[model samples]
Target: MRLAPGRAILTLDLALKLALVVLLLLAVVFPDWEQFEGKAIGTRILTYPLSGLLVPAGWWLFFRGRPYPFAADVVVILPFVIDTAGNAANLYNSIWWWDDANHFVNWGLLTAAFLLVVRPLRLSWWNLLTLGIGFGAATAIAWEVLEYFAFIRNSPELETAYTDTLGDLVLGLCGSTAASGLMAVGYQHRELPARS
Candidate 1:
């Protein structure tokens, strides 16, 4: 099945994701920005950027779009609003790494997403899992590529880069799985009313 075909309107999550992608590309395409910031960029990112910009962005995105009643809107938003933000935090590399915490939480979110989209729509589980995992894996690779290029210019240690990349993939898979589960469970129950 295909996503609803329409102009892709702007979302807060979309904005943050776009910013992260742009930031990585900018640094990779031009590595001098690392020193230009005098390492203060890292501190500023941890202290402010993630909380100030990214959180608001995710909150906006999570509530921006309208999804079907009893659908897995919350589940699908879980990745962008919750898990992906955590990933972005790690990318800044300024604070404690929480991939371990994000790992299973993302999986649960993905599971909810899966239930939301596929289950209610009568789509096959196999197809849902495949597509979700494929998307997550692709993004994971893209994030790694971004990081690798950034480090190439920033002159970070290779081992650190490798670890970061690995962490990204692991979390990506977890998020994907949780989203898929959400699709699986979406609209399956007619038991309760959703929040207004």
Candidate 2:
């Protein structure tokens, strides 16, 4: 099947554009910026818009030539946006389970996106499931390690707790597995012969 952009991609692009405009306006007009307070310029940029852009950026970098479904794009972009926005609003700090929930949902989304990317390969169900879950789990662990080195290591507020890291990894694994199962079922349904 030939790949093409659809309403979903257009809508995602529009939302991203709107986010960019909002970020710019805040940068220009918001004095005593709550989100950026006491944050380094580099960290501020990475935390807000840059962090939010990673999903679409990954799409451009890795999957631009492929034909991805609109739902796949939505699956990837929405949770990451929510996670970034939640972080900006300090929801992670306020709600104890918010971080865990984001980890589960966002990693699930990532796994689904990866499965969609590889759909054209026509891998076996088990292989597809393994790839999706493994990739998502590895990526989740890598992200936690990156966080430890970048923001968590030296911070007085954040600690590199073994339990927390393990919990995040477990949540990521669960999410990835769930997404992989859904992909398998969807593929099975699509493959079934249609009734006349």
TM-score of each: 0.43, 0.75
lDDT tens string, model 2, 1-196? 6435576576776685466446544545653656544333244444545544555676688778866455665565566566546645767767989989988888888899778867877887878888988898899899788767765666663654677889999999999999998898888778788999
lDDT of 1 by residue, 1-196 (tens): 5434331323443554565545544434554543333233333233333432433344355534544322243344444444334433344344455545555465555455444444434556566666667766665676467546554346645647667667767877777666655543443343346769
Query: What lDDT does model 1 reach?
Result: 0.49
The whole-model lDDT of each prediction reads 0.49, 0.70
Where does candidate 2 stray beyond 4 Å?
1-5, 20-44, 47-69, 157-160, 194-196
Winner by lDDT: 2
lDDT of 1 at 12: 40
Q: Runs in model 1 with CA error above 4 Å?
A: 1-95, 99-122, 151-153, 187-196
